[model samples]
Target: MSINCRTRAQRRNQVPLRIVALRFDFETSPQKIEQQLITFLRELRWKARGFDPADLEAAREADDWSDELLACSPSRHDSDKIRRRAQALADRRLRASGMAHLDKDAREKLRGLSDGVRVVQLPSAHRADEIAATLHDEMPWMAQATTLAWHAMRESVRSGAPALHLPPMLLDGPPGIGKSYWARRLAQLIGTPSEMIDAANEPAGFAVAGSQRGWATAQPGRPVELFLRERVGNPIMVIDEIDKVGDVLSNKGVNFALSNALLPLLEPLSAKAWSCPYFRVTFDMRWISWILTSNNRR
Candidate 1:
């Protein structure tokens, strides 16, 4: 393989003043070689465009075109192209309504949901610490968890990265442990909207993740509905009796399971690109904090 390096000024001027070039033959599979070439060309393009190499590497490793677009594009217009491409791919899979066909009600609902998907920006580390302290004081048993959560929040703030320190927490204990109460209390303390899903009664997973539009009685997912109603992105979602979630066979002859549906929402990467079954649009869902309570450890 051979690579050519050029000065930023030369790159800006579209000058081909190559500094150095090296060549090598690799004894690798054809597919591997093809992937390597593609990666090398992508890095070259990003560098030529004067984008941060680290950002390019991160986007490539994560397979996130949106991040890559943000790194390379200087204007929203350029980034929109990348976003549109991603949406097109998602549309191909789901065959959902396009943005052009979205009615006013659907657009308004989506706008409301988008507001709820964004992270709650904190002012400073001091405020984050204060919130943590208050949470610990209110729920003495969760002191350790609160401390860690605040530390993570402060670190994220300091580093100028999205706050993703707090992962979905599953509180497990016997009955009468105030598990549900604590979840609600935490949400109240954080000053965000909260919703409880009674998994024991609502066994169908579609209630949580939403049913596809083609299905009868289809509607937006619980989280989307909560966001639309509360008009907040970072709501506290508490799933009660999660272990008691029952399986159900859908009208499409597919088995729907709560745990399976919740998996993407619980993970940061997948949640960042979550596609709503109803709206059929992909949106970030990493802002929502999840709390699950189960009587049995399993």
Candidate 2:
């Protein structure tokens, strides 16, 4: 009899057998393993109480708005006014697009953007410490920089002011040393979205400060774009390869340099009342965290 059958017969007959060593080999093909893993995941998903479908749909709609807001050049767009109008229009469009079930209060808030100026609510000092710790964990080599930044952020937060002004950071280092990466990671750690501009390729300095409304294809500047997309005044704006920004000569035989365009924006006083060419409105942009990354060591 086969060993398996003998073992079963002995068990059924209530018989005691001599002690013996037994060995068994188990094997699974790659395909079978993959299938088992997939089954396990599906079972887990079925057991978990996942996100509500309505909430998921709302998040998708918000994501779509964010993407669209980031893609357009806001040359002539106004700051709060234009953004409010745009948001109202978007809310209408969303309603027309079968989201009639959206909360009435939310719709009213979008419409209310047109009536009042909204200030960004700064996070607490405790939150800033959490962000700093996360940054240190992500990039241990940047401990000094992160610590200083955290101190600044914490101080700003502790002041209990509605607006928080953060100093602009100019990161000078060689290529591949993670300067740009640090900026991006910092934004993520702070729980804010970031927008990166390649100054080397976009030679038009107007793109940073925005074109005048009289000019064709004029839009709002990069700062306005961040505020509109993220609905916050303090988003991180990263200008990569700032050292390589090129100068362009206009039709009037005037040379426009990127540094010249950035000078006013970088200054705290000037940035406090930065004018938007599109809406022709002055916006307080001191809260924005500007990060300029360059390959130049100097």
Candidate 3:
């Protein structure tokens, strides 16, 4: 084969570098020899052109270090390193996506973008007027709130808007009231996906990156790493029933990790790089459009 044809053929067969999904168990555990076989292609420096060696070396050293630790004790935890790597990958993706310049309109439109993701508009009088006209044939009160939300979102998205940060809205009303319904509709309008994260189930909440034992027992809240990594470029994360977030026993003493986690996100610049105490790596939540819902606070 001539050199040009050979090069063309190789290019056709080459697969792009992508994350090997991490799951801690019999299959993906450090104990499994196959886990190492799937070491990041970039990390192995196996003919990857234009790749950085420092990143490769760091990833290799991380895997090697974890292997050394687990070799001494088969039952000991080695999942933390893997979780950190996954978080790193997530952060890398965020930087790649240009971190879309978020305006109020963009954020409001986010909620309506998809399931488990939606745009939320805050209360506004002008929006109330517009919403009254649009949903005139539908429920009036619900329409009013939805309109206010849209207007607030619209103004918020405008140039030089104030940093109007507030705790997640608690949309409380009668049983048949359309709180969730409006939430879903707002998501649809924004054209983003939405997911309902339950703060009640701490284990499942933290398991998205895989079964790191320490994190499994960690108190429940939105997994900042998973949320930012997996759900970037989306809108409308509806954290449901946050008032019921439970207490978990920890080495530090009984702590409400959920409330603690949300507090930073509520504050501007606070969510920039929240270091997970369990994993010990920082994450960026500045771009996520969070709309939390709950019953009356206790």
Clashing residue pairs for model 1 = 1-24, 116-232, 116-233
RMSD of each: 19.2, 26.4, 17.5
lDDT of 3: 0.42
Q: Which residues of candidate 3, in runs, are more than 4 Å off?
A: 1-139, 160-167, 200-231, 250-252, 277-279, 296-298
Error of 2 at 195 (Å): 1.1
User: Stretches of candidate 2 above 4 Å error?
Assistant: 1-123
**Candidate structures ordered by TM-score, highest first:** 1, 2, 3
lDDT accuracy of residue 34 in candidate 3: 28
How does each model score on TM-score? 0.59, 0.58, 0.44
The alpha-carbon lDDT assigned to residue 36 of candidate 3 equals 51
After superposing candidate 1 on the true structure, give the runs of residues whose Cα lies further than 4 Å from its correct spot.
1-97, 101-104, 111-118, 162-165, 251-253
**Candidate 2, lDDT over the whole model:** 0.58
Can you write out model 2's per-residue Cα lDDT over 260-293, one digit (the tens) per residue? 7788888878877776655445666666778888
RMSD of 1: 19.2
